[model samples]
Target: MQEILNLEPQNIWKNFYDLNQVPRPSKKEEKVIKFMMDFGKKLNLETIKDSVGNVIIKKPASAGMEDRKTIVLQSHLDMVCQKNNDVQFDFDTQGIEMYVDTDGFVKAKGTTLGADNGIGVATIMTVLESQDMVHPPIEALFTIDEETGMTGAIGLDETILQGEILLNLDTEEDDELTMGCAGGLDVTATKSYSVENLSGDFKSLKVDIKGLKGGHSGGDIHLGLGNSNKILGRFLHESLNFNAQISSMNSGSLRNAIPREGHFVISTPTANFDELKSALENLKKDILIEFQNVEPNIQISVSDVELATNVASQDETKNLAFALMTAYNGVYRMSPEIAGLTETSNNVANVVVGDGEMKILCLTRSALDSNKKNLSETLKATFELCGFEVSFSGGYPGWRPNTNSEILRLMEKLYKEMFGEEPKISATHGGLECGIIGGHYPNLDMVSFGPNIFGAHSPDERVEIKSVQKFWKFFVDVLKNTPKK
Candidate 1:
C-alpha cells in the first residue's frame, strides 16, 4: 500500500489512504463520518451533519472567484462490503487492505476496495483543503448508506444545501459523463408450505451450483450472465421427471447482487435414486452448454447427504420450481431515445425456504415512470398467479438529463480542450443517488463522472491508476473554470 501513497496525485491518494483506515460499510458509516467531521473542523470549514448522518461542509471561494455560483460535490460514504469466502477479515473491526497491483490497478487483498465512492470522497476532501484552487464557494456533500438502501440520499434534507449545480463523482467510467440513470424498486413474493415426514424408502442428495460470474443486478443485467436461482429452477423443473422432492432451497445473499451460487436439498424414492442421478447429470450438461460462453466456470455437483425428517410435497416442490423457471430475470427492453441503453429490466435476485415459508425477491428498474410501474406490476401479477403474495418497496426516482445545461456545456468544453477528445455522454441502467437527490432539489443541474473502476460491489473490484491522475486534473480544471453566479 506504500506504493499507493507515492502515486503521482498525492492530494487525492493521501485522503484515500486515510479513508482506508476507517471501516465504512453500508449502514455502518459512523467511524468515517467522524473522520470527515474532524477533517473539516481541522480545516476551519463550517461542517454540519444531518439527522440521517449526511455531512455538508462549506468552503469559501478563493480571493478572486467569490462571484461564481456554489457547486455541490457529492459522494456517498458507505461502500458495498464484499470479501472472498475464504478470507476471515471482519468489516466492522478491520479496514480494507488495499494494494497497488503490478497491472497498475488499486485492489484489495481478497476484498472489495471501497474505491467506488472512496475515491470520490477523497477527491472532494482534497479540493476542500487546497488553497490554490480557484473555485466558487463549495459544498462538499457526503451521503451515507448508498450501497444497500440509499438511506442517506432518500432521507437527506435538501434545504441544507445552497447550491443549484451538483457534480456527482460516483460513476465508474473516466471518459463518460453520466447524464441520467434508471429508477428502481425491490419486489418480494412469499408463500407458505407444509412439510411431511420423508419416507425411509427415499434417498437424499444436495445439489450445489457454483462458479458463475454474478455481477451487479442493474449494471450487468444486460450482459447475458447466468442467474443461479433461475438456473437451479430450470434444473429442478427438469429433474422432476425422476420424481425428486425438494426439501429446502436457498440462493444468493444480496438483492442487488446477481446470484453466483445456489443450493438445493432433494429427496427421491429409493426405487428411482439411480435414475435421478443420471437425469441430473444430463441436465447439468445442458445447462453448461447453454451458459458456456458467459458462465464458463459454472459447476454443478450432487453429493449424498443425510436424509431430513420433513420435505416439501411433490406438488408444492414442483410449483415452486416452475415458478422460478418462468420468472423474468434479465433485460426486458432497450431505450428508444438513447442507442444501446437499457430501458427496463428485472433481476431475480434471491430465494430462500425456511420456517414453512418460501420467499423470492426480485428487483425492477427503468428510466420512465410508466415503464417502471408497468414492469413492476407485471411481475407482481405474474407471481401472484403462482400463488405467492407479492409486494414492492424502496422505490427511487430516475435522474432526468439536462442536455442544454450550462455546467454540462462548460465541462464538455474544458474536457475536450484539456484531453484533445470529446467525452462520451451517456446514461446508466443502475440506480444513482443523483436521481433521489434530484427529486428533492428540482432546480439543481446535475451530472456524474469519475475515474475508471471495474468489478464494483464484488471482491474483484479495482481502480485504474492512470485514470485517477487524469480525473484529478479534470476536476481541478473544472474548479478553476466554474461559471459566475
Candidate 2:
C-alpha cells in the first residue's frame, strides 16, 4: 500500500492501487461494484446500483458552486481479462499482478494491466473523494461489461442521471480529446462439406505464421501491422496454385484483436512436398521484408506431420481460402468529414476448422450506423460470393459528435487553461459507453479523454504514470469551471 502512495498526488494513486487489488474482469465485477458502493456510502454520497449491476455515485457541488451545470464522469468498471499462456491467474478470483516498469509504466505481470478503463475509474474515484475540490454537481457512472459488450450502458435508465453533460475517461492517448467513436458488429461464417480420404501418396506439413504484434484492429489498423490469419490465407492461396491441400486451420482467440499467430496443416503429394517447403521459405522472406517495419520477426515455417485421412476436399479448401482472402479486414474507409480518421474497419478475429466446415468470425466497426450496416453487408456479400454462409450479430450504434456542446466547450477551455495548450479533439476507432449512453439520454453532451495507454486488450498493456497526473489535473479543472445553465 505504501508503494501505491509513492506514485503521485497520493490519493489518486492510492485508489488506483486499491482498484488493482480487486478482480473485476468483464461481466465478473461484483466485488469491485460492492467496494465502490461501500466507498460511496462512506463518503456520504448518493449511491445507486441498477438491476444490471451498473453503479452511479452522486456528489453535490462544492461550496458556492451548487448552481453550476451538472456533469457526469463515466468509465467502465470491468477490464478485458487476457494474459500470457504461461501465466496462471484467474480473472474470476485473483487480483491483477501490478508492478511499476522501468519506463515508469504501470503494468500487470503476464496479464493485461487494465489501464484502458481502470485508470479512468481511479481518476473518477479520486475526484469523488476529494474534499477540497471545487466543482459542479458530479455523477460518477461505473458501467459493467464494457469489454465484452456495452451491456450496462445499453440497459441504463436515462432518468437516473441528472447530468446533461458526460465526460468519458476511456480514450487511450493523453493529449487527444475523442469526440466520437465507431459502432461495431460481429459476423460469423459457417459452412459444411464432406471430408474424404486422400488416395494419393502425400506428406503432411504444418505451416505456421507467428511473432507478429497484433494490436486492436481498429486503433492500429492504419499502422500496417501484420494479421497472421490473413498472411496464412495468402500463403494457402498461393499454395493452391501448386495444388496443396489443407487439413486444418486455426488462428486468433478474441473477436476484437488482430491475430498474432496462426497455423494450418496441409497435405501435399510426396513429389510436391519439396516445392511447398521451398515456396514457404521464399514467402517468409518476402513477408518479412514487406512488413519489416511493423512485424520484423514474422515467420512462416513448414514441418512434417503424421498424414491424416480426414481432410476437406480440394474444392472446399479453395473456397475457404478464397473467402478468407477476400473477406474484409482492417480499415474499410476513412471519414471524409474528419481528415485522417478511420470511418470503418473490420477485425477477422477467429478462424476454426471443423470436421466438414470452417468457421470464420469477424468484428466490424463504424462511427456511422449506415456505414456499419454497409460494411457488414459488404463482408457478408464477400463470403456469399465466395460460396459460404454468413451471419452477423452483436451490433451496436456509434456516439455521434455534438459540436455545439456546452460541456465540450467548457472542458476545452479548462484543458487549455490547465495545460497552456489546446487539446487534440478527434474521434476514436474503438467503441465506448457514450454511444449507448446517448441512446438512453438523447440530450446528453458527451466527450472522452484519458491518459496515455498502450497495447490495450493485450498482455503488453500499460499506463503512463506521468500522463495520469496531467489527466487528473485537467479533469479537476473541468469540474471546477463547468458552465452554469
Cα RMSD (Å) per model?
1.6, 2.2
Per-candidate Cα lDDT values, in order, are 0.88, 0.84
**Can you give the TM-score per candidate against the true fold?**
0.96, 0.93
Q: Which structure among the candidates has the greatest lDDT?
A: 1
- Against the true structure, candidate 2 reaches a TM-score of 0.93
- Index of the highest-TM-score prediction: 1
Q: Model 1: per-residue lDDT, tens digit, 1-485?
A: 67888997988998998998899988889999999999999999999999999999999999998899889999999988777656899999898898899999999998879998999999999989997888889999999988778889999996999897999999898998899999999899998989778757888888888777776777788899988899889778876887888888888767777888888988889888888888888888888999999889888897789875577778878878878977888998999999988999998988997557889998889999898899889888878887889999988888888898888889999999999999989899988999899888888888899999887877778999999999989988998888898
* Cα error of candidate 2 at position 242, Å: 4.5
Q: Which lDDT tens digits does candidate 2 get at residues 121-227?
A: 98889889888999889999999988777889988977899897898999998888888888889888888888877887888888887767776767877677888
Superposed Cα deviation of residue 278, candidate 1 (Å): 1.6
